[model samples]
Target chain A: MSRESIVNAALFALLIAVPLGALATDEPFIITLATRAVILALAAVGLNIALGIGGLVSLGHAAYFGIGGYAMGILAFHAQSYTPLFEGPFVIEGTKLMPIIWLVAICGGALAAFVIGLLSLRTTGVYFIMITLAFGQMFYFFTISWPAYGGEDGLSIYVRNSFPGLNTLVPIQFYAVCFVLLCAVLWFNARLARAPFGLALNAARQVPHRVEAIGLDPVRLKLVALVISGAVTGLAGALFADLNRFVSPTMFSWQMSGELMVFIILGGTGRLFGPVAGAMLFVLLEYLLGGISDYWLAFLGALLLLVVLYGRGGLVGIFAGKARNHD
Target chain B: MTEPVLSTHALTKRFGALVANEAVSLDLRPGEVHALIGPNGAGKSTLVGQICGAIKPDEGRVQFLGRDVTEQSTRTRARSGLGRTFQISALAMEDSVLQNVVLGAMGAAGTVWHFLRPAMKDLTIRQKAEQALERVGLSDLASLRTGEISHGQRRRLEVAVALTLSPKAFVMDEPMAGLGAEGTRELTALLDELRQEAPILLVEHDMDVVFSLADRITVLNYGRVIATGSTAEIRSDPEVRRAYLGEES
Candidate 1:
């Protein structure tokens, strides 16, 4: 086994063990915190498909994330109120089932990513980043102005929706759901990075001319990656909304996009489990440090500076010693 | 001309005040190496660019496989059986040498979108890439990262990459630039064998390699073709001697 793989395994075990220990001690807040880390990490995993592997620095992923959150919030809200989602021409019923909500969130993410990626992939480097950022802002303001579903005030679910054979209301049960999904998405991202498509996509990121000469359309490949990326982030967004039982335009904010990127960078760019490690560190610091000072973010910024300046591979690099192409 | 596999007709390109390539027309016949030699800034790169669909010719037509490709995208040109190597190496440095060659073969195999299965697991692609690597004597280094290879090895790897396409015609820009004497000799020999597989349009500054390997030579100066003929004829052309080859022995 490679050192990186061992570190990855250790990370997985540690994340799982922490919540279990918290569960034993009856510190349910710790379990909730762990669940937040998993959900945020899952969202970053989605971004890594484009940001890390494809070298697409998307600043609008929060649009898809927000869309996912809204899907969950709107559906559960209507289902609880016994109100139809659509009226007049055809009856569209809302659903409280986890699987159905997941499907909806994925589709919403896929659609948004497809449209946005189509236009954004035409430009590259800083232009691509800014274009995506602009699209994200567009969604942010659109959501705030769309007043029907609480708009700027946001929508709240009275209770967490049910998953088959599981009471999602239980903190530990919810954490398990998020944990399993995180593992599945991480596996999927890893599989993709090693696939033929992934090889071409990575090549495109480095040298687009070479990719073109090889007869592959770099833009098309990136578009597909963006859609796949958005789908995963969207699913995480839905889970996030369920965690808080609330959805807001804040989900679409550029700050949310930056934070998603932060998770990937903090762990290590392009590493399979980088986002997960980054999220754990991020959430832990936020929790442990929030207790110390109101200006906790100042310390967090300094830590990020230390990592960027000295650590080449983020947190994982510090532990695994800069394993290349591990993803 | 037997309808040369690749042909440019009256291709003209200008960058504002500079005429990078002017009314340049050329052809590459099957199983022959046609070397394009010129001084720096003589429009050899521009002409190569026009042929490979990298730069749009202001006025002209390019045909590949007997079909007009003047307006085709670079990827489209490549898909239509054109292979290209950069003047500078354009490789995915982090990927294995085998992976780089596999990427070179991606367009021909029509499997660039297969997401679930690992590319290395695809026996067909893996073997094809390996065969190309073997031809270039880099098979032993297949699993090594491209960045770990020497400069000369990377040049050979570029040829190995082009081979995977099974290209009908090759557009190689300065394939031998920056190689040592030994590296140049090895590449010359490989390119000699390579022409039997597919015709090559080789652009270079190395006259010895050009004279030894090229079946036909074309001389370009200041965006225009000055002469095109067999190696012997080009060697004695007074106008060519005066214009570009005056410095060489």
Candidate 2:
């Protein structure tokens, strides 16, 4: 195998082993934290497809993430309450199965991303960033006001969603599922990055006019990347909801979107495993700092500012040097 | 006689109160090099933009391959066989030289949506891209990052990208700008060789290269064509001499 393949494999194995080991210790705190890290890393990987490889600075990934979580929450509530989703010519009901909830979450997120991308891509640069953030805020406010599924109080699943063959109530099995999903998303992301669509997307970012001059439209390519990103992130959100057995408006906040970007930036933009490293560091710092002080987030904010200004490549650059290959 | 491959009629553009291009009319025939020369701020770039559909002319029409393209997007214009190179080489710096050429070919192929297909694995696209690089004498540097290549090589790569489209007409804006004598000589030879295949609308300031390579020359001053004639005629015309050639003389 090539050095790159070996390194990637080793990283993947390490990610799985670390979380599994933590769960084996029978410590609820550690298992919960590890699960959160794995889920957040998956979300970061999704954003990286667009932001890192495609060079799209979408500030609305939280909308998809939140939608995914809400799908799980709303479905579980209706399933437990024995209520139908809608009453009309045809009745729509909810299910508590993990796979079905994941599918609904991903599809919903992708659709939302498609609409947001269509409008945001009309402008470029900082305008695109702000527009995405605006859309995300709109979703956040809507979720906060909507009273059907617990509103601002949030919705609790009561019973965690089930997978086909495994006992998802077991922390280890649940963590394993999350781990497998994270790895799958990462693999898919890497494959997409090396594909022709990814090449055109990157080319559009670097020299859009040249891409156009060669007969490719930049806006269409970017929108496709955005949709893929949203779908992947939404899948992570479903996993997150299952992990917590709850979903809330906090999932759709700008802070969540900023954190996702931070994960990519911390690892190194456009580098595979960058999001994994960044997520681990971010969660670890939050855990350690929260134990010590109430103002830990302030410290994180300062640290992020420094990283953005000084350590532009993030931790991946520190260890791997500059990313020689495209993500 | 067959219609010209590309034509611009009464192309006029305004930026606020200033007229950047004023009723400029031009034509490009097949297998010929038409040079547009003028002093600084003569609206050559503006005309190029209008012709390539990057900017719409306020009061004129651009025709490509006998179809009106004045309202077409830049990508549509390119798909219709109008290829252009920028003044500053606009290559993807992070990608390899081979990848850059392949992107150009892929743009022409219109297969950018094949998300699962590896671009480098496509033998046909790679072959065409390599052939384009070879034509520009850049095959040896194919694996190198575009950022690492010499400025002159990047400029040549720009032309290679335009050539990869097998365009009916090539619109080059200052392809020789910032190149040394050796680089200029190399590009001049490449342009000469390309003239046998497709017509080139070259907007250049190098009078020496212009006089030697251009079959016909159009001189613009203050957004108006002051003279259009053979190189010999342009060089001797009293008005052309007084307006532009006087400075070089």
Candidate 3:
């Protein structure tokens, strides 16, 4: 195996062993922390596709992330209240089943991403970034103004959603579910990074006119990447809402989107597990620093500055050595 | 009686008041290098852009492989067998040479959309890209970072990129720019061989290489085609001598 793979393997082992050991010791709080790390990592992985490979610096991914959250929130809220989502010949009932919520979340996220990308993909660079940011703000304010699912207050779930053959109420069991989903996403991401689409997308990021001269449509490739990115982040959003047993308009906030981008850059922009490492560090920092002082964001900002300046590659560069240019 | 592999008729493009190309027409027939040459600000780049689909013409048509493709995108025209090389090396600087060539091979026929299997695992794209690299004598440098290669090698890589498209005609923009005498001679030999694979629409500033390789030459000045004829024919044209050939120091 390559040096990077060895590092990746070690990271995965540490992640697995820590949570399993916590489960044995009956530390529900530790398991919860692990779950939060995995979910945020999952969300960042989605963003990494567009940012790292497609070179799309989307500032509005939280639109999809929050759509996923709202999908779960609205579905579970209706299920708890025994209310139909819409009045029609066929009543649309809310569901507490995890699979159903996940489907709804993916669909919602993908649809939002498609629409946003359609309009935003026309412009590039800072314009693209601003348009995406505008979309996120649009969703954020729309959710805040709409009164249906608690408006700005947000909806609350009475219980965590159900999965087949598992008691999700148990913290470790729920963590296992999220962990498994994260692993699946990681696998899918690795496959994509090596695939033709990924290669074309990566090349397009570096040189779009070259890609076009070679007969591939760079915008089309980016659009597809955006939809997939949105779907994955949306899934993470659904899980986050379940973990909190609540979903708020704050899920759609711009800060939430910036935080996701932060995870990628903090860990390493292009590396597969960068988000995992970044999220772990971020959560730990938040907790450790919060205990010391409430001005933890200042510290995060400082660290981000350092990474951008000297530690250009983030945590992965420190561990795996420098990656070659293809990444 | 055969149709030209690539042809543009009365193609016109305007940027507000400046006419970049006006009633420009040219033909790239099979097995010949049709060189487009002019002084700076003479609109050669603009005319090439119109033929390559990078710049949309305000009026007239571009026919490629006997089809009217004036409205098609650069990508559409390319996938349909019109290839292009940029004036500046427009390579993915971070990728390996093989990966860069693979991009050229993979873009056509919708094979670029394959998202599950690794591209290297697929023998077809790898083999084809390698073959293109071999044609340009770049197979040995396949694993090298494209940015690290010498300028001559990068220009050859550009040719290799277009070669993978198996083009019926090629639009090469200043492929000979910035090359030394030796590099220019080596590339000229390569183009001599390449014209058999596809007719080339070469835009170049190097007069010697243009005279040696081009089967025919077209001179442009201020977005208008001043003359189109054999190399000997253009060398003797009075208007060409006054407008461009004399201006070349």
| Pairs clashing within candidate 2 | none
The parts of candidate 3 lying over 4 Å away from their true place are A325-327, B247-249
In angstroms, what RMSD does candidate 3 have relative to the true structure?
1.5
Question: Considering summed lDDT, which 10 consecutive residues are worst modelled in model 1 chain B?
Answer: B240-249
For every candidate, what share of the true interface contacts is present? Answer: 0.81, 0.76, 0.85
- What is the per-candidate TM-score for chain B? 0.98, 0.98, 0.97
Per-prediction TM-score to the true structure, in the order listed: 0.98, 0.97, 0.98
Report the Cα lDDT for residue B67, model 1: 96
lDDT of 3 at A171: 89
**Pairs of colliding residues, candidate 1:** none
Query: Positional deviation of B13 in candidate 1, in angstroms?
Result: 1.4
Query: How far out, in Å, is residue B157 in model 3?
Result: 0.7
Comparison by lDDT, 2 against 3, better one:
3
**Ten residues in sequence with the least summed lDDT for candidate 2 chain B:** B110-119
Model 2 has a DockQ score of: 0.69
lDDT of model 2 at position A275: 87
Give lDDT tens digits, candidate 1, residues B1-249.
Answer: 376999899999999999998898888999999999988989998899889988999999999999999989998889877988999999989888989998887767889888888878888887898899999999889888889999999999998888899999999999999998999999999999999888999998988899989999999999999999999999999989989888475
TM-score, predicted candidate 3 vs. hidden true structure: 0.98
